[model samples]
Target: MTSTTTTPGGPALELDDIQAGALMPRPNPYAGAFWGLRIDDRHAGRELLRRLIPLLKPASSFDPERPVSLGLSLTFTGLRALGVPQESLATFPAEFQQGMAARAAELGDAGENAPEHWDKPLGSADLHVVVAVLARDTVLMESLITLAGDALRDIPGVVPVWYLDVHVPADGREQFGFKDSISEPAIEGTGILGSNPHEASLKAGEFILGYEDETGAVAPLPQPDVLGRNGTYVAFRKLHQRVAAFRQYLQQSAADRAEQEWLAAKMVGRWPSGAPLAVAPDKDDPELATDPTRNNAFLYGDDPQGLKCPLGSHARRMNARDSRINGDVRLHRMIRRGTNYGPSLPSGVTEDDGADRGLMFAFVGAHLGRQFEFVQREWVNDGSFIGTDEKDPLVGANEEGRFTIPNRPIRRRLKALPSFVVNRGGEYCFAPGLQALRWLAELDT
Candidate 1:
């Protein structure tokens, strides 16, 4: 008995109790696979969530002949390995109970991106249950990973340690070629709109749990309210990408190859065909980057001196829309999603092909500390609110980074700037809803 809709003014979501990859989008030549699961036993993790709730599918059963979906999340030690109550895990949110590897120095994730150099049951607690799946390729993502490996055949302790497999490359571009998951946010009642039609929507409890957000209140749940109403919190990660040190640091900071593709489109304010250097600032237009209403319709408050983008660009330090930062870009909006893993680097190869490619990011929200750890500690690892202490010159954590670029007859800094994305680990999930996965498979524990 789960159903709700209401949008004319907001608050009523329950799109059949959410989770269709937390608000559907990501099916453009897809094929995914995440899996993690551990749950040593609590009745085999409630019989692997009652055989994955009849192969989960909601968010009003998305479409395109199912385009293949499936999602599920957990951790907070998989809700205390499925037993759940320590006062309902003390009502969740301490940045999702100190997860994401105890907030890795608040997400700059230090030299060689820490968490003791991750990638082992990713930031473990034996990594309890993630299981994603997507599709539209790899033969329907291996027939939904063989029906999620036949619901972990013979469950027992429920292991399946880890797995990755992400995709999207029919020229969708992301092992740093760019065009990644354009922009996302618009949540209100989730008719899913925001690719920036001047951005408004937000408030569906800032992304699902219970309701009313954008601070008109209600953004804290996770107790008996049927296991946190229509849950949502996810984070995910697993980055990596260094595609031959980002194409030999854009061929030693440009002078050829069309100024190294305009210095990788001013450090990614977009145009490996996702357009937008505040709307095609003089180049790569692939027809306005495949025009979806003028590709994320421009606005850095009309380029505030960053000469069409670069206010420490990485999509304008991730959504600084009307520019002027130092907080409140719609209270740090998030919903991001990405996918691309292994094998891509061969176009005029800059070298390092010991390939273990990148990006499997994800975020969804309900305020994991004001939206994904405040956009990974203030817009992708700090740049002094765009004044520059320098980071996010394309996935920060750099050691010798410095990147200004406002230019016309002057500003083009870029010195050194290494660390082309690494941190191969991450987590801080929750996802529930679908009647909170049938109240976590009728938790009688």
Candidate 2:
């Protein structure tokens, strides 16, 4: 159905046409904020979008050494509020139209993830827009927010309903003490693809809309050409991590510090230093982890029996490289950009810290139903494809699940896996291309 050969050439990425947040991560932003707003007046909302256009950051703004980033995404309701026609709105994927709460059961978001427990803005009908800002520190982030507010001062209809902030430590370690953002999919068009030749590059349409997907057909586009040409759907989620419980579990499971680290790596498929277990199975290799060219260069084919990397591990299941699956892996690939939020618990403190902390997960793709939702419902939360019923150890919602780690002496099974990650809230948003923003700004009520 899809091209099996790994094509070295891909469509040239139109960086300026795409929103920066959809393709690349902010350059080491220390602080960030997500502003969720509701549109009270369609005309005012359109004018506000016009005013905000100048502030929208394009994908071209990403500089690995830079210190500033800001971007915006809108819910389907937000677009409708801005005067986008009903015909165009109907063209969006059903998942986006229904919102995240409507399909909680399919996403395994029952119990704590029920709509009643979600943030008010995410579940309420009033939510329209989500503006995300990231910067090197709090002061810079505040300044940007202030500038945005000043731009929207004349627009009275847009009201802020919720604000969530993100905190990334200097060391770049998550609350669970592992290096995050270590692995990401390489898109064909984006020149940002690294020299990790082992991993195959995915089709451009897998991430960006209006491009040919893996099946060699241009992915579906929303009506009114400018509105959906280069835009992509985004699944924004706030995941809270129980750091104390996770650390305590590791401590009680393993006999010593080294074994504890090993158990943790087996669960995550990566060492604290960001070194993947598939490459450095025995110990943490900070050098390899730090090396961009070598860190993501391993595959699962060589160790089919889970010797190098367990098939059910979090990373392995999330992106199963060269693993046998019912369908092509490219079809399910998504651009995952997650940033740490909340303070890190003090080392060696086993008790729960009253402070709340976790990750702000953003999944960018063209097919929300097929790409993001399928991966969440199938790969991450269920392990049936890998011949196991257990979910991902660190983030899966199943507390009764167990993780089996294959070792030379014997396979180790870690049980009583409590849910370490909780869905604080989430929304399905549309990150439009620059032209779409302009089109939205010019819309008439």
Candidate 3:
């Protein structure tokens, strides 16, 4: 595919106007996008960027096994953490100039398209530290995810919104295949292709992540004490290892069930080569595999059992399709453009043993907990959907041991669970405003 966008020199084009949500095929350098989260006077964050921007050289190289880049997002929840003088957090934009924003058109339906502000009183967003792909070196991106995770551990209140330690499949699709990222909807004005719902539609201050004053822990919103110039909130998560096992299970499933590899393809909703199940349910649809429009078309008509596709399967459960009971579930869709990490498991390996391999899931939304959290807790993990208490068998967690999706006949054979993925370590972080940067630098490390 060809593109009209060029880095030649001019005001940047709106995000959606760029092809495939990118200026080119891979990541590129964004000069003024890096930001930090910390307490500071009004506009104090700028000083820190002035210092860090020059010290940081344009990246010369990326690691083969693990690359490093910064990804950025913000949260209004951090507004609660501020001194009286700088208490008005919503007015101040983030410190980074090149970063993405949720812009709304001025004409009709502009506010309608914007996330409802029911919970967004001031529209404050507390986030920083975006590890972008300056260039497309999968390894570099991988390292960047880890680097962001590791670095944020020490930053106070910097909650991680959503992250994906992904491996751009050698086949070019995401871990679930189905032509990675074909389903992301284009939201105008934000300069982003997002799946987020309007913040105005949500409850009071319920949209922020890491710290929700109303519902803490499961949904921690920013507090009034941290309101104006609140410390950052980093979203923390660790999708565990199971790459080798999943592949092995698929192969074994094919042999044990007497079905062909195509069956396994349907189970995953994609061909190993990135094709979508919607276009080719019985065979790997190569044409649809590459065409963005053709992917993500399959929806279970009414077979609650998911006979067409396993009810509890990842794709089916993630996007409940039209089956979702209310508008609540509609907000949970994530823009998962993450890649996988770790090696392509040896085809013959029986088990990953203790191999640290799995997806690095990165997603974005105005309020992390309301959308992603709701889906993981209610839909993905609920037994009602798949017939067992499995937290997204692949990405969910159970304190007792590893999580796995039970095989067919879920109604009766409820105990057979398979561990497809695991979770590791994580924390909450915030990508701060430029004024906040100086505060971070000023703080005693």
Q: Write the per-residue lDDT of candidate 3 for residues 12-116, one digit (tens) a residue.
A: 222221112111122321111123354333223333233343222211222323223443323333333333233344333332111112321211112222224
Model 1: lDDT of residue 298: 70
lDDT of model 3, residue 369: 48
Which candidate ranks first by TM-score, i.e. highest? Answer: 2
Each prediction's TM-score against the native?
A: 0.35, 0.94, 0.55
Where model 2 places Cα greater than 4 Å from the true spot, the runs are 1-13
The sequence of per-residue lDDT tens digits that candidate 1 reaches over residues 211-328 is 8787677887888887898888889989898888888888887878998888889888877888888877778888878877778877788778889778988888888878887878
Candidate 2: count the clashes: 0
Candidate 3 matches the true fold with a TM-score of: 0.55
Model 1 Cα shift for residue 354 (angstroms): 1.8
Task: Give the distance in Å from residue 245's predicted Cα in candidate 2 to where it truly belongs.
Answer: 1.0
Best-fitting candidate, measured by lDDT? Answer: 1
lDDT of each: 0.83, 0.82, 0.39
